[model samples]
Target: MPTTNKKKQKKSSDTAVQGTNDSSVVSKVSAASRGYFRDAFLQHFVCKVARRAPLINRGYYVRWRAVDHCVRRFLHITQKCPKKQILSLGAGFDSLYFRLHADGALDGAVVFELDFPDVARRKAALIGSNITLMGMLDACSPPAAGPVSISSSRYRLLGLDVREESQVEDALGAAGLDWTAPTLILSEVVLTYMETQRSDAVIGWAAKLLPQALFVMYEQIHPHDPFGRVMQEHFLKLNSTLHALRQYPDTSAQRHRFLQKGWEQCACLDMNHFYEGLVPEEERARVERLEPFDEHEEWHLKCSHYFILTASRGSLLEQALLAPTAGPICGPHRGPAALGVRPTSACLEGLGMASARVRPDQVLLTGGSSRGGRGAEARALIRAQEGWRSVGVEPSVDLDVRLHHSATPLPGGGVVIYGGRSSPLSPTPGLFKVTFDPCGSPAAPDSERAEAAKVRVEQMVCSGDPPPPRWRHTASVVSHTGRDFLFVFGGKNQSEPALGDGCFLSLDQQLWMKIPVEGAAPVARHSHSACSYQGGVLVFGGLSGGGRPLGDTAVLRPTDGGFCWGRIDVRPPPVPRYSHCAHVVGGKLVVVGGVWTHSDGVPGVVVIDVSTRSSVEFSLDTTAVPWPLMLHSFCSELLDPEEPELLLMGGGGNCFSFGTHMNPRPVTVDLKPALGAGFPSWS
Candidate 1:
């Protein structure tokens, strides 16, 4: 009786862990039901599960979006090609197959989901019990008696211990998975729970079986960080060990694992940067406004610990999968869209101003001077398919000579520009508004631009106490408590050291509230690249108060009522520099040309993984990047989501010579090849 009781207790413990795994699916369904995001088929799988808490819903929403993005990319790549297969390892109760089928994105694709026997049997029972799920399957072959395995033309569900090599192989064979065909294997937070050897075997098995395939995995990384320690503790409390995390704690290690296991290319990015930069901005905005949220710090901390890693081989998987321009398949715009026009000449002296995309086809550029030491009054209208063109300055608008200001895009289709240096040593405190009228007259030729004006700039006065006058500060638009607020972070105030303070401007109330941070705040700096990442703002390399360049990075997260700052310590940090440009691609902070203390002045590009806090510096090939690439206004376009290209406009001179090459032609840097193979030993 004692032995039996012990066995029963062990079984109960195992069941609890399994339940926790299944609960994730329930959370996703609950989130979808609450309108956090749409997943019509998820409801059928969950079958009236209890709604998750708002925080859980948001986490699931982010997870769903990341996984969905990867799945959609796979589907888009295999759309026109021969029938491909997708294998979901430890799929649990995931409704991906049903969802994809419902959206008609699963055409010519076979899906196979594998999990432990107990979990799979329960899922099989659930499907068998549900007529709707059963009906969705084609004329499928009946499973062998008691074992729950369904095999169909398009979908297959199998129950097996994935750790058993023979069992996994047998299950795949029985499910009719074409090993030789192009395939995409998904392991979402699955392998981390398995022993290191077991997960390695699973990866090795897949690599050996699929000649042309892309393996995508979403799992926890950076287990040594403070947030990661909390994550570890939570899993430990749940009696589930993150077995593989210790072995591959960082993205670099994960990349190395894939490379060692025969994958030709591997790319990994944390959910924070991936969600912010890779996910569609429109989709992010829609889901962000779904629920009232104020846990900005928690959201970023959680996302920073989780990452998506993709490993690929073969040209088909390499070129097609994760390409940004791969548009809607099997629809009106079924094929790839034409690459848009590239900017030739942009302001070289706009060292710290904001550029907002006001329309799908247009971007507004304001507050920058020309290389000839003249403040630019005529705002530039960068149109799609057309190069940069000047918008005639309105005589009614009293524009000030401001540099280092921030321009934040409003939800109602406008931009709020605030805080910049009015003179060489003074900072301005007022805010400026720019609104566009699409119904206005078409833009006339360059000669008639003065008479035919369209865009308008208005200066506004606020009611609340504004922040101190500062320049080179960063501003990001974030949603808080069902309202949009503009968050401004560190910059230098005139005659004062770089200010580490931050504040938020409530657009509706026209109120400015200070964000009192609790943790270690970053040192005051200017000319830093601050971008909206996850639920907060990520500030990268900047110039310190003593006219010294800084290479540290920090993030400002909104806590329960106030805010907190966390500084990320990167190993072998990028050279201390300022007046540089940074862009987020996947999970990396790509730092472009900046003035370093070194003699070269313009060092090569630096790529830092925001997740693991590891960095790799790549010196630009003189043949590829034009020489003397300092102070250039760098912009990145996701021509392909998997591989983004960088464009450098203007700015090419040392500290001794200000704007020698004033109107430098744009230099396009194809980063795809560099990203693949981990930017290996660039000359």
Candidate 2:
């Protein structure tokens, strides 16, 4: 690339970075409008107010809460100081100064915000036009002059590029910054947009200039996972790549970067840790109730990818800096010596679909929302000498468009699919039992993608007490006496956040009947895994009513009368997860892929030996699978009745505004490496 072209590219990238300020302010205004936080001045910066999804609202709320927590802590710590300061790098349309002034938190403290010249000028113009914003500003220095866009006694907004160290230093000095004052430097999602070398120079410059400082930063990390990949690609498309993530990919590496630059003490925590450890339980509950949210998988993934960090130099600020937390943290993110597994394609893709093995070489899939949108039709993954291929299945009856339902194979044949929804408004009602063609789906030898199969469906009308319409629940075939029953358990409906109630549908009698269910029930949860164990079923992790993942493994075993529940504790405990699939083969429970919190890596395979009371977790090697192998909202089935192999189909979901990511094809995992020997030797 020529130097002239490089300069133009850099200029264009800088403009795009400035444009981010506009979008960010709009999101902040939306979050404030929804009452996630109190920011009266943010609305003035945006031309219009648009409502964001609850997930995005929560994302911004956590970012706001983390930053506010640090700011308040800094203010409280230096309350007695005659002069203090807060310098926000790449500040852009932020309403921090006015909000602080309105709250009367900045008495002797001064705020200095620096961004690209364009963003600063726009922010200054917005402030000058708003009577409310101008009212909060100091009357001594009216808004706008030169590079110093808005100049006031308590607030100074400078329009200058942050990469130029000498320029910013001289500019801050001219704006009345006390070099020796107790300063809190905030950089929220900034710095990462700059080149890694430039960002490093900026970090070094800040540490070298501010002797008594507490640096607070919020930025992206873990750019290699499925969600992280989508996040990186989103920025790439915008031509503003996250350059810092390549070098500083996690909390530890980020903290190390600041320390290596010049800071003394540093501590970093992902948003998950900050939300769980710092935010009070009552406060979290209050914020959660403000909106209706169903995107738990994406929410957790978003939290895991972004982080909040605090690094300090002076002893006074070091004592008050964010501390590194370990034991007090919540969620299931324990990094262990990993067991690696390889990935292969099964040639089927979608999300929230239910899968069941209807034939030796055929797996029935029904009801999921894909990138092409949700359809009432069903698809089948037909296995041959090659790999599994998906085929369109024509059902005798019209199947309603639904996702996150349960498909359980009956002992006789076919599958009973129950309870799913088109959207979060409510769970869809009714149940259907579909039996596939005996000879397998007919398709051309080479054109599996363009062929159709046949299946018979019937609406099963049941009597007695049917379970409330719910999706993301488990419907398993549990045998009692000589009869097989479709045991329904734990899922959430629109009216309820989580459901713990269980119901039994007798497959023989074709009616919902009462069954003696003994022992203490697990907490209300959704997106759990239940597989047939002995004569009953073993239930695993799920998202609880409190919006946390449950890791406890419980078994409901037959004891001559009915069934009894017993909790099992496996050594070397697997991380708690939900939206995964499980199967029992030869007394061992094979668990594969799901969404988890706090951890940096995506979920893989976790195998538990029921007889030995032991468990092991293995990370997937997705080199061969060209796309990101997101494992949530997906379905998996055993390739063989007795083999320890799983054919996982249709995973991924809307990745929290980044975009929708669907596993382009089904993936197969050979559990033999994890269960029998150990991880396979790639070498």
lDDT of each: 0.66, 0.83
| TM-scores vs. true structure, each candidate | 0.50, 0.95
Worst 10 residues of 1 by lDDT: 329-338
RMSD of each: 22.7, 3.2
Candidate 1's displacement at residue 598, Å, is: 24
lDDT of 2 by residue, 1-683 (tens): 99999999999999888878877888888899999999988888888899988888999999999999999999998998899999999998888988998899997999999998888878878888888888787754754455788788888999899998888888899888999999999999999999999999988988898899999999999999888898999999998899999999998899889999999989898888788778887888889788767788988899999999999988678575465343543333222444443454455668888888877777888988867565535887776656666777778887788888998898898889899888888677788998887353334462543343568899998888787898889999999898899999999888787999888899877889888879998889999999988888999999998778777899988878888888887766678889888988887788888888846477787777776677767777777677878989988878775566677788888887788888877777766666673421121
lDDT tens per residue, model 1, 1-683: 69999779656655655777667878888898888777776666665778765567777877787778788888787788778988998898888888888778888999999887888888878888888788879887788853347777888888877778887887688667788888989998878877799899889888888888999998887676334555676677676778888999877799899999888888877665576556676776667566654223245446657778889988888863333332221101111111222334433333333566666434555665556556656344443334444454452465577666777778877888888775645666578778755443334444354345466767776777777888777788765556777888777664555776677888887788755568877887876777676657778877665434678888777677666778877766566666666767777777776645332213456777777777666655543332333343332322334557665543432111011233344454656544442422221
Off by over 4 Å in 2: 140-145, 321-347, 438-452, 641-643, 678-683
Q: Which ranges of candidate 1 are over 4 A from the true structure?
A: 1-16, 146-148, 320-683
- Cα error of candidate 1 at position 580, Å: 24
